[model samples]
Target: MNNIDGLDSWDGDRDQSVVLSEELRSRLAPPLKIGNFSVHSRVLQAPLSGVTDLVFRRLVRRYAPDSMTYTEMVQASGVHHARSLKKIMDVDPAERPVSIQLFDCRPDFLAEAAEMAVAQEADTIDINMGCPVNKITKNGGGSSLLRDPETAEAIVKTVVDAVHVPVTVKTRIGWDENEITILDFAQRMQDAGAAMITIHARTRSQGYKGAAQWEWIRKVKQQLTIPVIANGDITSIASAVACLEATEADGVMCSRATLGNPFLVGEIDYFLKTGKLKPKPTIAERLICAKEHLQSLYDYKGKRGIYQARKHMTWYAKGFPGSSELRGKLCRVDSVEEGHALIDSALASLA
Candidate 1:
């Protein structure tokens, strides 16, 4: 298989060994057996809409080949009735050991989507019960499931029976502070046969605000028989370590943090396994990745590729000088050449 810039191969960079030796106080990792799949890596890539596309996943897979990655959440109702959704569910062969996440509250529709995911060669099917968007909630999907555990569990039971693959769930603590029902709700899901659970430690009302409630993750882990994956508010190596240390979750999944930094998933997974920080990618490395991402978007979407790449380029440009202005310019780019020139100029300024 041709590697994208040798993504699957890494010899570790300078100080890699030294850093590994420094973080020897190993955290207890929960070993989860979901159906016939076993993941040795603790950090999973939480499915983010529009962000966890095939190209973005390829970037992340390069650094953390074995770490579990997720596609952007697929709408089951849409997938059941539309060909466009099926195209979105497509996974590259290089992204083996990956899970396809789906949303919607209808058990029957979700079941059909699950079967489709199986046909597409997914190792697992993930149900999304944590999205807070008004549209999704209004449709009785996403975080709205928190308001109706009965329906959520039914979706799981139906989907589990429909597919031979393991079915998992990604959800929040509750719909809002007043509706905290995670402990009981999670138990119901477990009873209904969800193989694994990923809990983003905040209520839907919080909407990615406040500190992630690591304590809630600890509570779920203590209450559930399956592996409990912790997510939310983790963006850096230190935060990743802290999330694991505080929650005692079986694994950590980086959502927004993995946005521009594809190397994060593998870097953290490697640190957990070998206790080391791989060498940081330099400015040149970032520029190369940005260009490759631009080209891939072009390949994936044709003339509209520039529009799709704008957000990705903006995400990659974070933590650099003139980033915000560059993002504005990138968002307005209508051609691939212009996007490339903007990124090249940004990289040159950094040098």
Candidate 2:
């Protein structure tokens, strides 16, 4: 198993659905209330930078209709300075329960961004405090806020005051193993009027590597009065159930696992709502989705979308024979027709 489009780990038996504990099921049955806002589903789609664009969101929404979804993180300064809102901040009116996520260390800029987000019909405003990328952290935003609790608190407080919609924060547990400061950080966010907190259960240093230390989520949940969402490693229903039972957080948010698999959140959501498991998409069905995703990306962003679709196309070309070769070809696709042809051929071969 040579990594093959990076889905080697996901090839495990999909038949074994994790049974939710009676206590966990009972606890999560109600709508998750974030201040005045209420979402019918506990499972949420995490905002992935360079992903979670309007097209991607629409695909996820089709399956997980009631789950909350987020836009990619927007720069608060960008939102404040631009004459018009950036395309990344775009949210469809029909996409209910959508939260617009903004990142920056400047409280005033973040406040201004939140106002713009509300005008765009965001259900809530989410502050991004957990992005570990060098560019974001060096700019005094993202997970760096974890190191500066005061600035993070001010951002939340300011945004909450500026917008009628509920304000929330998504952050990592700490900067590293030595600075595991989430216990205090989460408390400060709640006190600063953040309506909900989503904790990515790894330090900034981990950066999607290593196992997510879920114990930190349990600790944060014990202290927060606001809804606490447990994120990180929530790739499947089994992982979602395990995290909920272990941490007892208000909900789970799906991230990297959803890069090519938009059905994951819906599958987990359906399982939580009903005890039965949703069937995994067959290879042909997945390729069909891949084709649709490619076409939509092209429709939205033109050539740039096709270029960006390359990576996404590769992500979808997995879990079947010849998938590795297909990924190799799809990653170099130069046009919508080229991408579609490659996927169609793959499907034909499988058929």
Candidate 3:
């Protein structure tokens, strides 16, 4: 395996250095306090469905030890009826600063799920009010909560009362451009006892398209006292610092940017803490990480994990020679050995 440490020289054109302003550095210097829990690093790993399982998070934790990470959003109703949901909520005790993100319209079910999350030793309970999937929204959960602030508030208040650990909310700016209600909605969540709020900065209708309207996050942060984390378009250290400066956000969370590169969170965290840029991983190193990810998923979930690894493998096979061809081959891989062979072949070619 080609470890990141083995790579000393990188293409300077590919890695741009970001200068952190004194004001921004001083502002983010202190620990991010979520209720009573303190996370040393301001950068967080967003809870991505099917992508942020224990196998993936362990890889992320290897790079960003003190940063907070979240479980993929679990359906509160699923937890209420099925024991199988436990697999998604699985948290390693070593991953101390992790949160279990749960989504539902029902306050009781969310509260029950929060309790289960605490038992799993989650550092905090994050309510997913920002997911924009139609299935989630039509079900009266996710970003739909942005439209129904009453239930959203009730969910937060109920869960805060139900759990001993901090309860945070991750939400979008609004349902759509015409209904940008984040200011009022964010206030309601804070009033309802939310310790922190992470703003995705896009309307639910956008569903991740368009430039994230970061200005809305700036507005919400002004009206709230709790730590505000800026999400959406936070891909690189440059973008993270830019967002924090633009929004005056307490932190920035990495979402889609971390798809194939788990090193992103730590890269931003290191830059924020020390005003130094970490070297970007070479393509060969990335392929090696992808190979390890494929094997780890297989070790954890057997054949089903390989099916999931297909997408992840494709995400890794990019930005290099023959990557397009490699991705096409990777997405159809059926076994760990097959995936390893493809990545190994890519690595050998890079060498």
TM-score winner, 2 or 3: 2
Worst 10 residues of 2 by lDDT: 1-10
| Candidate 2 clash pair list | none
Off by over 4 Å in 1: 1-32, 83-85
| Candidate 1 lDDT tens digits, 88-139 | 6879987877899999989999999899898888999999999999999999
Question: Whole-model Cα lDDT per candidate?
Answer: 0.80, 0.90, 0.89
Model 2, 240-281: lDDT tens digits are 888888999999999888878888889889889887788888
| Predicted structure with the largest TM-score when compared to the true one | 2
Steric clash pairs (candidate 1): 20-275, 64-266
Cα displacement (angstroms), candidate 2, residue 220, comes to 0.8
RMSD of every prediction? 5.7, 1.8, 4.3
Error of 2 at 26 (Å): 1.5
TM-score of each: 0.90, 0.97, 0.95
- Candidates sorted on lDDT, descending: 2, 3, 1
